[model samples]
Target: MERAYKYELLDKYIDQELSDKERQELDALMTEDEEFKEEVEVAVMMNASFNVEQKQRWAKLLEAEATKTSVQPSQPTKTSETDTDQKETKVRQLQPRTRWLRIAAMLLPAVFALFLYLFLANSSQTAPQMADHYLSNRHQAPTITMSQGNDLSQNWKTAIKAYQEEKYESAANLLEPLTNSTNATAEQHFYLGLTYLYKEKAEPVKAIQQFEKSQQLNPAQYSAEGNWYIALAHLKNDDWTKAKPLLEQIVANKDWKWQTAKEILEEQE
Candidate 1:
């Protein structure tokens, strides 16, 4: 009976919706059953990995909806306690093992994307459509329109303009060519990583790759940023063990990114 009960809690455990008592029960089961513990770990990883693409897709859907309703779009208005209670009741009636936790976790990346889009849109009123299209297509921005003899500052200005217009791909493409120049510095790689990070919703794999490249190219100051991206990649890939170390490094860093890194680490806990 205890063995059967432990199996029953698998879904809840994966979704992280188990009550304190139920969790305690699961701990006891795992202590006595190594196989059961491994099974639960696999299930949790599977759940996180399977849900990654779905979460990104939902973020795109929300982006499309927001674009369509551009003028003061109806936001995900904060829910009241009564509404939450009602939803919880409905959820219990329908979902076999609680799905709210999955949905909530899925919202994190989407919220980040939304905020990024809003920031870019507000800054690029002159080319709103281009910005929106770029974001929607998840393409990188083209490099600066530099005719020969353009100064470094001028090139960076162009890159910043592209970034402000939310042409992350273009910004990245522009910065990519510069990284090969003898004068290129760590800041360039860091900015390139920033471009990839912005497009995380559309091309997470690419983002991870670029972030890794940034770390390799500039380890002095961008190591923390690289580690943060690594953690996010691990989170997206459902490789908790792989992510934990990188997240720990970022959390320990006394940098501005630490606050956000700490928050994410806490969530995983």
Candidate 2:
């Protein structure tokens, strides 16, 4: 748990058991310490090689073992001697090929754990520089207004006008009450979400909740469009996990601007 490497942490790392905080700390160490960085790089390479070879070897050994077991003579004969020899032969493959390699083997798990743990953590981090690059540009406030309905709907008209004018806080306040009303529409929830998602003083978590509610309120009309807003909200928050599924969903459905969603997903890698 300390900044220095511990065999226990290494064991967990190799076993894919490190906590998120521990993994991030290891990533920071790699950036700050050259010696540690080199050790991790070497360990990662060696462990990857070992795992591949070990899997292949185990596969072949199991196949041969199964064949031998199946083709046994009808006579009830036990070959403890043959079994022992076979085990010894197979185990010999796991032994280090050289003295230096043997010494490194003891420490490799720690370094490799650090390397692998950080790699996994990297998979879910934010890419702020790319978040708004294209998706944000493509967005525009709705041209049509829903002002023809009752008094609750009339507030949405005011909210939309406030939003288009970039009066985000006022727009958000105006729309918030509308969502709690029995007369609330999916379109109303969606507009409130946009107000919260304004780049200036953005509240991305609130934005996501609103967008998801919009979807639940009217799936037929808002499934694709609501998912799109939620994805944008996640991007604004620099949350890869929340954004990626929506991006993939959009791409799979060939939704509006699906090509751009694919590009964003690729860049995340």
Candidate 3:
């Protein structure tokens, strides 16, 4: 039952249906259970190995079956006192399992795919699509609050709030003033870069400049994340050549997103 529950969690996760609490529980499992992590990685790659057309076909079938089972009442299975009827029942039981075996036959040799199959299927798809998916799912901006009393400016607080609220233009305007302040730090420029990258009709060029400036000001603190955003910025501009090397660097240096970068680079190739 415990094992079945774990597989249920994986299915919900791959389906993007995991609640926040369940996601945290799964994260703990991944960190503590190597076997489960490996299973998840392979399952993701198998799902991603489907071609675009095949993915859509399978997705529709899966969704339909799931809905049917969930919303419709289950019909009772009647056992007959006949050999022919028993044979039919046995075949019915094996049919779904056989179908799954056929699906697994398409597995790629790789263990993991970047987007849990959301962005793979056709790895050559547009870079901006990939970048947008990654930014939406993978990026997390640190929360800044004045309660800790770390000398944070009001401007920084408001700008981050705007950023969190997805009001990128307001965030950019608020962050601009912070960047001009006497005590401006790398973090301020870093967030401003993020705003420029995400604001309506995004300015990737300006975003790249701000990320670079932030890295130059404090390489030790900002270099890892700075390079990550720069890579995505290049991707947003459809410059795979630029993004490729930065992702490679991330993998080489074992940054926090190294595994994600490695998988993204692998998918493109």
The models' CA-based lDDT, in order, is 0.62, 0.70, 0.77
Prediction 1 TM-score vs. true: 0.39
* lDDT tens digits by residue: candidate 1, 24-138: 9989999999998899888888888789667767666665545533333123333998876776666566544334434544556576465455433232332222223233433
User: Which candidate's TM-score is highest?
Assistant: 3
Name the candidate that leads on lDDT.
3
What clash pairs does model 2 have?
none
For each candidate, C-alpha RMSD in Å? 20.0, 18.7, 12.9
Write the residue-wise lDDT of candidate 3 on 1-269 in tens digits: 35588888898888889999999988999999999999998887776766555866766555444334334223435665586577666777866855554444335213223223453335866888777777775345657555845777677777878888889999999888788776778888898999888877888889999899899888998899898889989999999999999999999999968987897898799
Q: What is the lDDT of candidate 1?
A: 0.62
Which lDDT value does model 3 have at 108? 28
- Expressed as tens digits, the lDDT of each residue in 1-269 for candidate 2 is 45546444554566788899878877787688788777776776888889967865665554444334344233323479797676665556444333345455454547544333322223344555455443344346665635744544567778878888888899899989988888788888888887787747889899888888888999987788878778887888888787899899999999966886887777677
TM-score of each: 0.39, 0.49, 0.56
